[model samples]
Target: MRRICVFTGGRADYGPLLPVLRAVQKDVALELRLLVTGGHLVGQQGMTTERISLDGFRVDEQVENVLASDTPVGVAKSLALGIAGYAEALNRIDPDLLLVLGDRYEALGVAITAALRLLPIAHISGGELTYGATDDSVRHAITKLAALHFTSTEEFRSRVIQLGEDPERVFNVGAPGLDNIRTMAFLSQHDTSKLVGVTLKTPVITVTYHPATADPQGSGRGLRGLLAALDRFPDVTIIFTGTNIDQHSLSITKDIEEYVRRREASTRLVSSLGQAGYLSLLKISSAVVGNSSSGIYEAPAVGTPTVNIGSRQDGRPRAKSVIDCGEDEAEIAAAIDAALRISRDDLPGLSDTPYGDGYAADRIVHILKTVNLKPLSCKKFFDLPDSYFYMCSNQRN
Candidate 1:
């Protein structure tokens, strides 16, 4: 049996990785090794490793790397700590292959460690662009490091090849996160309200706004503006899922707590919704109000309209279900009002999601089961003409 190792740093990665990880575990030909780290160990972010055990996946290893300082210094220290921890873990586990998702800093550090260890890495959701954060660059970097690539869209697959990965090694298997929504049973309206501890109001909008991280004003000021706009809708029951761990992540979380306290009955603030609950929340929401990729990738598939704020999701494709706007209160409020008008309950005719058809996990699982890992270790840079530069003397004069 091939030993397949999966690394999950926190809520975002684990939620999407869950279905795929389970598929690997069940396959008779493969063994699953789950290494949990980063935000799973952090207290304020709900220490979501508990969610992992609750969901029934056995974690094989744990590497604690998240730090308390929310400044640039803290971020750097976290990365250094993650690299050291990952290197130590990789040596101890010595898996045949490493599987990582998305473009987070944790994935970047781990990918480098695996590459040096001569372990073939398979990367999912590669070749996507979101210029607002440093993550954009990190995603492309992982593509170059990985031996195999699984992309959400065909366009993204092309971008991966453009980065010089072999086309035969790349697969356009769509987004695995969609697999959960296609398979999981969600809570009904009454159950959802009971689980969240409030009677969700009509025109329920689930809000999760993260900072641009690289933005000049930081996430706090812009998120505060979003809250101000949300305050305008006193009657709307708004569920604010907290911000990620970034420079101003805490500031935004604190502000949400204060705002939710003042509007107790009308608002709810929770740190991590654990995948199933989050998808169920989207199922009942009138509109998803946030800059999260969930608004772009998963919301449209569930037939929920999204009011996307700011340039965080600047370059990604959106379905007909999304409405883009600035961070200003007036603009955000107008967009929310427009989103509330979407009448289609589940998946609009000609849906807005360009991600996938919800069978990504099955496809990815099949590839993992059969793909040859020996040759994958010897990778070649398949450079495209567009990616090369002509030195002044190399050009015909």
Candidate 2:
């Protein structure tokens, strides 16, 4: 059996990796080894490793690498710690292949360690652009290190090829997170309200803001603008999810805490809602508001509109349901107003997303099962034809 070691850093990747992990574990020809690290181990991030176990997947290894501070230097030190911890874990597991998703620094550290160890990597969600955060560079870096690429869209698959990865080894498997819309039993509005300890209200909005590391002002300014915009709708119930463990994340969290405290009756801050609860909330929400990629990828899949704030999700393919705006209070408020105007009757069409048909995990598993791993250790950069650039130029016109 070929052992596939899947590396999950935190909630961000874990939600998408869940179906992939389950597929790997259930496949007879594959052995699943899960290595949990980063925000999964951080208490402020909700210790999501427990959620992994509760979801019935066995944690094969746990690496505590996150530091108490989220400063630039602190994040760098944490990356160093991650590299060291992953080195030991990968040496012990020594899987036939390393499977990692997204562009988190922790995932990059894992890829680096695996590359040095001569372990082939299969990367998911590669070749996507989040121009606002440093993840754009990190994701591209992982693509070069990986042997096989599974992209969420054909455009992303083309981008991976543009990055010099062999097109033959790249597969467009759609977004695995969308698979949850089909497989999971989502909670009802009443159940969701009970789970969140808030009464069901119309025009409900779920907010999940992470630090846009590219922003010099950090996430606070954008978050403040979002809070002020949210205040414009006094009747709307706002549910805020935890901030990601990135630089400036602490200040963002603290700000959200204060904002929620001030508007206790209408706003609630939930550090972690687990996958089902969160998705369920999205299903019942009037709109998902934030810079989170969830608003870009999953909200539309659940027939909810998204008010995407700031540049954090810029360059990513978005459905028509998404309304983008700058981090100014007026801009955000206008976007929220536009998103709220999207009627329930209009949402079904918006659910037709570019991501996929919810079979990404099955497709990913089939390829992993059948793909020849012998040639993966030796990668050859596939240069684009001269005419390819010409075609791109023509399209630009």
Candidate 3:
């Protein structure tokens, strides 16, 4: 059996990867090894590694490298520690391939160590753009290191090929998180309200705003502006999910906490809801109000409307369900009021997912099962002709 190492760093990152991970685990010809670290171990982030245990995954290693400091320097130091820890663990396990998802800093550390060891890496969610945060650069860097790419959309697959990766090795696997949505039985509306510690009478706004924290000063002033907007709607109940660990991540979480605490029963602040429960909440939510990627990608799969704030998701594709708003409090309040006015009967049914269907796990497993097991080659750079470069630079498509 070929050993496949799947690394998950946090709750948000794992939600999209879990279906693929389970596929590898049940495959007869594959040995699945899970490495849980980062926010999974952090107490404040719900310690989501427990979810892995509950799901019956065989964890091979856990590295605790997350720090309380939410600054650029702190992020660098945390990455360094992750690299060291992952290097030691990889040396012992010596898997045939290291699988990772997304472009977070923690995943970047795993990519670096795997590249240095000449281990073949299969990266999902590559060839995407998110210029608001440092994640954009980190995603591209991981793409360069990865040998096989499983993109969430055809557009993204083309972007990977444009980045110099061979087209034959790249597969458009759709969004794996959607696979879980198709398979899992979400809690009923009443049960979901119970789990969230709220009565079902008032409208529920599922909040998941995160700071574009890689900015120079990492201020969540936009998020603060969002809270200020929410204060206008006195009857709505805001179920606020916590922020991630980036520069100013703490500030974002703190601001959310203070806003919710001051508002008391009007807002309920919970750190993490595990993936399944959160998706269940998405099903019945009046509107998913935030700049988090969940609003752009996952919510639409379940027919949920999103109120995306500011430039965080500036250029990404959107469904008709999303309502984009500026950073001003009045504009956001107006947008939410408009969303609240949207009749459930008028809401469109879940359409064919542009990001993907629920088949990413099968496609990813097929590639991993059939790929040649030779050590990945990273020395060659894609050679572009001067003519092509000039045309591309001049905006001639």
Candidate 4:
């Protein structure tokens, strides 16, 4: 059996990795080894490793590396600690392949460890852009480190090839996060209400915002603008999810907590909602408002309109149902108004996303089971023909 070690740092990557983890475990030819670390072990982040156990998956290893501080220095220290911890854990588990998703610092540390150990790495959700955060650079860096690539769209596959990875090594398998919408049993409106500790109400909006590490003003200004916009609609029930452990996250959390405290009657804050509750809430919500990738990947899949605020999700391909707006209160409020105006009946067709049907997990698993691993040992950079560059230059002229 080929042992595959999957690394999940926090709730952000866990949702997309859940389907692939299940597929790997069920395959007789594959042995699944799960390594949990970062925010998964942090109490403030909901101690989500327990949730993994609740889902019937055994946690093979736990590495604690997230520091209590969210500063750039603290995050850098945590990344160093992650590399050390992952090196030790990986040496003990020693799987044939290392599977990682997305562009977090923890994921980058593990990928670096795997690269130094000469272990082949398989990356998912690569070749995507989040220009407003450092994750954009991290994602491209991981793409270079990985041996096999599973992208969510044909456009992403092309981007991976442009980065010098061989075309054959990259596969456009759609997005695994959407798989939950198709397969998992979502919570009922009542159950979702119970999970979030709020009564069901119309004009409900789910908010998830993270710090844009690349932004000069940080996440606070954008978040304040968002809260002000939400204030414009006092009757709308707002459900806020916890932010990821990024730089300036503490400030963002504090801001949200204070806002929720003032509007306790109409607002709720949840650390983690698992996959079912989150998707369920999306299905019933009037609109998903925030800079989270869920608004780009999963919301439209469930026929929910998204009010995407600011440049955090810049350069990502979005559905027509996604309304982009600036960070000003007026801009955000206007965008929310536009999103709320979208008719439910007109959404399913209008939200036709380029991310494929929700079978990405199956495609990723099939490639892992059947692909030969020997060629990965001698990885090479694919060079585009000179004519390709010449054609680009001619087009520019």
Candidate 5:
């Protein structure tokens, strides 16, 4: 049996990986192991570690690395702690392959340790660019470190190849989040309204704004602009998910709480809704308004409109379903106004997601089961001579 280890650290990363994790569990040829860490341990967002237990998955390891402090220094120190914890746990479990998703520093830490141990690494969602939060750099770095790549879209697959990875090693499977959409039968409009404690008969908006805490001034400016816009639309009820645990996230969290407390408003702000509840919210929400990639990638699948504000998702591929706006109050308000006007009949037809079709788990499992792990290696760009460029078919030199 091929032993495979998958790591999940935060709610944002976990939302995309849960479906594949389940598939890994059911694969007969695979000994699926789970490594849990980061935000899941913190009680802020329901402590997903407990949720994992409730979901019935046996946890193989829990590495505590997140510091209580929220600063760049804290993030740097946390990376070191994560690498140490993962290296030790990996030595004990010693899976043949290590699987990781997305661009969190914690995921990068584990991937680096796996590479050092000469274990084959299967990385998902690599090569996609997210210009916000330094996640773009971390994602590309993981792409170079991993031996096998499972990209969510064709664009991402081509990017991995351009980065010198062998084309045969990369597979473009649809976004795994879409799998949850395809498989889970969401509640009808009536049930969803009851779940969120709001009436869905009117316009419903879903918002997920994570701060770019890496910046010194703090990243709540965009959230402030969005809040100002939301204030203008008192007719619509909004659902707000908490920000990821980055350097300034705590401050942003406090700001949001204070804003909600000060205003006796019609909106409901939540710390989190699990994968199921969040997806159900997507199904019923008239438009998803936020800086999250979920608005860019997952909303279209259910014909949900998206108003994506700010630079967080600057370089990623998006569908016509999205309206890109800036952090300015007026621009954000205009985008929200446009989004509210988008009727259900006018919602973008479910486009073939650039990310994938919801079947990444099977492809990932197949590669892990069959690939040779002995010669674990990364891609290196060749430096060809200028004189030989004419003779070479490739575009080097």
Candidate 6:
């Protein structure tokens, strides 16, 4: 049995990995070494660690951090702590392969440590571009470090090969988030409202905005623009999910609390919603207003219109239901206006979401269970000279 260790540090990554993790757990040939770290371990997002155990998966290891800082300096120190923590954990678990998802610094920390230990890594969602955050760089860096790639789209697959990885190693499976959409049981609007402890509002909006790590002062400015835009829809019940913990997290969290407090009657700020609740809320929401990839990837599956603000998702593929706007008061407000006009029923047929069709997890599990293990731990880039294939064909002729 191959000891496969999956590392997930945030809800954003963990929720999507659930399907694949479950598949791995049931596979007779695999030993699922589930490594929990970062945001999933912290109570910042509503005690996800407890939820993980409740979900019935046995946790293999819990990596801790000594630093609680959110500044760049503090984050750097955290990375140092993560490297130390992960290295020690690996020493104990000693898995044959490491699985990492997304581009968080915590994910990067594990990938770096795994690389040092000569452990083969299977990276998901690599080669996608999100120009707004330093995630673009981190994603690419992980792509280079990983031995196997499970990309969400064909476009990303080609880009990964262009980065000099063997094309055979890159598999274009659809986005794993689509699997939750395909399978999860969602609460009805009334039940959802009751579960959330709020009465149902006709035109509800769900907003999730993370810090634009590219710009130092951009988080506050962009958030203010979002708040000002939402002011126009005073009657709308806006459900806001907390931002990812990053260098600018403290400021974003503070501002969101202030925004909710000021608009207390109409706004509710939730830290984490398990996959079912979150997706169900999106299903009934009039618009998902934010720059998060969820707006680009998952909102379309639920037939919700998305008012995507600013450059956070600049180069990523988006469905037609997604309305792009700048972080200006007028632009955001206008986009929200257009979003409100979008008929929910018409959304399913309108845009073609390039992400996936909800079967990514099976493909990921198949690869993990079947792929040969030993040679993958040590890899070499097959750098072929330009026109070498053509020349070889001519010589053969």
Q: lDDT per model, in order?
A: 0.85, 0.91, 0.83, 0.92, 0.80, 0.86
In candidate 3, what are the lDDT values of residues 1-397, reduced to their tens digit? 9999999999878999889988998899899988888999998788888888888887799988987788789989999999999998888888999999998999999999999989899999998887677788899999999988999888999788889888778899888888888888988888977877776455879898877755433235567678889988888878988777777778778778888888777678777887788999888888899888898888888877889887777657787788998777888888998888777766553453578777789889988988886735553556555886798879964
Clashing pairs in 2: none
- Tens digit of per-residue lDDT, candidate 5, span 70-128: 78899899999999999999998989889999888999999999989888888888888
What is the C-alpha local distance difference test score of candidate 3?
0.83
lDDT of 2: 0.91
Of the candidates shown, which would achieve the greatest TM-score relative to the real structure? 4
Model 1 Cα lDDT, one tens digit per residue, 176-266: 9888888889888888887777898787989988868767373455576688888778789989886778766777777788988998887
TM-score, every prediction: 0.94, 0.97, 0.94, 0.98, 0.92, 0.95
Residues 99-183 of candidate 6 have per-residue lDDT tens digits of 9999988889999999998999999999899888888999999999999999999999988887878888899998898888888
Q: TM-score for candidate 2, please give it.
A: 0.97
| Candidate 4 segments whose C-alpha is farther than 4 A from its true place | 349-351
Tell me which of candidates 2 and 5 scores higher on lDDT.
Answer: 2
Candidate 6 off by > 4 Å: 349-351, 388-397
True-structure RMSD for candidate 1: 3.3
lDDT of 6: 0.86
Over the stretch 246-363, how does candidate 4's per-residue lDDT look in tens digits?
A: 9999989999999999999989999998988888999989999999999998999999999998889998999888998888899999999999999989888223877889899999
Counted clashes in each candidate structure: 2, 0, 0, 0, 4, 0
Query: Residue 89, candidate 5: how far off, in angstroms?
Result: 1.3
lDDT for position 371 in model 1: 96
Model 4 TM-score?
0.98
